[model samples]
Target: MRQVPTPFPLSQRIPEETAFDRRELAAILSLYGRMVAAGEWRDYAISHLREVAVFSIFRRTAENPIYRVEKRPRLRQKQGMYAVIGPEGQVLRRGHDLPMVLRVLERRLIRSVD
Candidate 1:
């Protein structure tokens, strides 16, 4: 088959997909490991979309995500790129720093041994 050239330039021709870099994934996975050890999280999933990258945490494989850590580059200048969302579709925290935003969940982990 012959290739058909589009009107858009080479930069526009390529589809953009958002994703987590190694450092970002490292931080997220570090928290995930702790949560798993604490028995707060079990199953997990990662999604890379055109607009956002998401890491969903689940208590069980069959259940909806208990939390979602997402990165939206568009929001970087406005409300920051990193966000942590709760199960009820609420934004738990949003910030320019991934570790800072993740502190919301860390607080929960540090509270009460029970």
Candidate 2:
């Protein structure tokens, strides 16, 4: 049988999905757990797409997401790779470090508790 050429080289194969790695997920889950215990969040969904990974939070199952945390590797150079988006589709924060970027939500939690 004749040899068949592969469409793309092994090193050039594009990723099928983008997802939060173990460390990133751990951080996200930590905050999520706290918010849930505080009665500030009820439900959440995680999506791994071709170019972005998103963790969406909802107060109620039927309502829209109250917040969305995203990771885009493509933006790692210019704008950082992690982002927190509010319900209004606004960028609450973005940075190279996930913990630093998530400080905005921590501040919200503090204010709510006060």
Candidate 3:
């Protein structure tokens, strides 16, 4: 009997994790900073998965995230690649541009100012 060698090791065979690029992170962080300064957002987490990247915003460290910004490259053609999801798992906004999609959070900043 002969054994066939895999092209990639088992540890590396899965699809590469998707993540936010430098420019995307910069834009997201800029909004995060503003929200933090406004006292509307307190914490955040970033996650890279096989098919999506997420940036979750939290009002407190121990609570569930209040909002989540997501990137799904697989949806880039049909429904855009970016989305803003509310705490209840509702889609607040979706678009191809990161800054534009993030305007949903900016609205929160507006409400906080009043």
How would you encode candidate 3's per-residue C-alpha lDDT over 1-97 as one tens digit per residue?
Answer: 9999858778656568989999999999999999899888899999999999999999999999999999998899989999999999999999999
What does candidate 2's lDDT look like per residue over 70-98, in tens digits? 99998999899999999999999999999
Give the Å shift of residue 61 in candidate 1: 0.6
In candidate 2, position 82 carries an lDDT of 97
RMSD of each: 3.5, 2.3, 3.5
Give me the runs in candidate 3 sitting further than 4 Å from their true place.
Answer: 1-14, 112-114
Model 2 clash tally, residue pairs: 0
**lDDT score at residue 33, model 3, on the 0-100 scale:** 98
Alpha-carbon lDDT, every model:
0.93, 0.93, 0.93
Q: TM-score: which is higher, 2 or 3?
A: 2
Candidate 1's residue-wise lDDT over 1-114, tens digit each? 999986877766544799999999999999999989998889999999999999999999999999999999889999999999999999999999999999998887786656
Off by over 4 Å in 2: 1-7, 112-114
For model 2 the TM-score comes to: 0.89
Rank by TM-score, descending? 2, 1, 3
